[model samples]
Target: MKPLNDVIAACPPSGIRRFFDIAAEMDDVISLGVGEPDFVTPWRIREAGIFALEHGYTTYTSNAGLPELRRLICEDLEKRYGARYAWDTECLITTGVSEGLDLALRVLLNPGDEVIVPEPCYVAYEPCVSFAGGTPVRVATRWEADFAIDPDAVEAAITPRTKAILIGSPANPTGAVQPRAALEGLVRLAERHDLYLISDEIYDRLTYDDTHVCLGAVPGARERTVVLGGFSKAQAMTGWRVGWICAPQAVAELCVRVHQYTMLCAPHVSQIAAVEALKEAEGDVREMVADYDRRRRVFVKGLREIGLECPEPGGAFYAFPSIRASGLDSETFAERLLHEESVAVVPGDVFGPSGEGHIRCSYATALPQLEEALVRIDRFLGSLR
Candidate 1:
């Protein structure tokens, strides 16, 4: 009858999904396309979910999520990053960081507002901002600068319509962790422009070399920063779809209002599981992070040996290496790599134009599969030459 909303219609489909669907059909494909962790949810966490179900905890949680969870999240943030978030008024549990991002944008943006996003970023960042009735202004981060967004570039992009700055450290597509000085600079920038800073910290616990600085923890940032985090990446709880948002009181209250209408609340059982994750899964998280670090080293070394120029990814389980020497655009590189060698990866260009000559290879898969994928990639590169 009526056409769908124009904004929804205009949003592009996920670039990662194209190769994911192809890999799903192919019998022996080795996929490095998705950013999900391969680890199973810790047994304790899963057991908690089962216990909740057995006790008939199937009802919707409070719109802000379980009180215990919010408290634990706040304590954990303070203990780890020196950030202070009040569990009562400053934190709201969400379906996932995806939902938190959406809710934050909805609460903060009015029609025609602009959000400055640095690329190559998570696939959903730009579209989510747009779907919330904001304009996404993409500022390119250079591979030469290790993909860290420059504060100067961010400052240059701001205009009167600019409303917020969104950033992801230990970023998707490119595993670049922003530096402390850079994050502080961003805080200064936000303060200067009276803009909200949305920091996606899903990979906070997955960093390898440097500690992740919680953006809101930077001096003078608490009032203007919204911190988004989740159990999906670090706790390997992707299917559970549990995450949280921490912001100043007014912003968090508004986000809760939006979330209550749009999401109602995160699943009761999943929230219980997340509580257990925060309580007893610290050892499991450490082991998984150690495993990812090992894989990151091995994968980056393999790519360099195979003639691709890969900067060592500092965090996250991804390695975004330049395939420029192969004389193919990222889309073609990924397409041929999958068809010829059955190795599926996300083409970098789908992230943004700056990603055109690169590809994102996730090392979150097992060691044997990663090794096999490397061999196939090397063979593919040889064939290309």
Candidate 2:
């Protein structure tokens, strides 16, 4: 037998999914582990895909995607964040943010290049960098600071090998949205060091308290930034598998060069559906955001009442709560709660070392499920005591 690729062979499987799989095998398991929105795709967007099929529009689009969709993406970003990019030369339609992340990494990284990734991040960040042949330098973000990236730590981690800074906002697991000032500082760092900024803004529309600062909108960042966005989280279009990458023309050209030889194009039907999402689904997105806000309020308060302290998650649906009170490490806490109380959550350490004492619970579930999950969690904590 031949050997597998060493980098991938050594990479760990997604910790978020391990417990999710376990829960899938059990009945009555209250799973709050996955970050997916519970809402289905808005009717209009789904109908657009159906309409495309009926109208025989299933042919592959140009490697860049449908021009109309790309234009909408550019217009939406400019309207929302003052960022400008050419719809034709600077935007690419990817299968999803996952594929966009891979494409962006492949486009920017060479072997041994480094990407500074802030911790308590989404599970995929580090692995994706590794898969792209880059070293992922993890900078820890503390629970004390609500998991915000410290520019000083990031600056200290920078070396000649460092080529980019990868970040996810309205971040998964922790739900900590990076502050605007910090984003500015990061842009300054990138500008000074001639590094790239890979900003994953998938949850851009799901913020509850703070506005999402677009990294590309930062005065000097856009020229060096790769913005990865999709309709999955807010538009509830996960199954549609459509997303985009917005970057400078040179970077985008290379991305399309690689994409054309690889993915070729995003699914035509999905691209059509995504166009409808960008154009006509704003009201649907607003209603979903409002509903998530309500669920966020209930879930966070419930967690507090149960004595598990959690930082205020400004944007994403997850709540990374400290389970240090349980006298168990995050892995034990999450594992025991799942078996004993039928509540599923992810151990925070899977995100990074700094997440050791916490567990990630998604509030994206229905109100009643969240309430029940909280009750079960409280009882589980009592049992531990």
| Candidate 2, superposed: residue stretches over 4 Å from native | none
Clashes of each: 0, 0
Question: What is the C-alpha lDDT profile of model 2 across 286-306, one tens digit per residue?
Answer: 999999999998999999999
Provide the RMSD of all predictions against the true structure, rounded to 1 decimal.
0.8, 0.8
Per-residue alpha-carbon lDDT of model 1 for 1-385, expressed as tens digits? Answer: 9898999898878999989898899989998988888889999999999999999999988999999999999999999999999999999999999999999999999999999999999999999999999999999999999998899999999999999999998789798999999999999999999999999999999898757899989999999999999999999999999999999999999999998888999999999999999999999999999999999888899999999999778888899999999999999999999999999999999999899999999999999999999999999999987
* Residue pairs whose backbone atoms clash in candidate 2: none
**What's the lDDT for candidate 1?**
0.94
Model 1 weakest lDDT span, ten residues long: 208-217
Superposition error at 148 for model 1 (Å): 1.1
| Backbone clashes in model 1, listed as residue pairs | none
Model 1, runs deviating above 4 Å: none
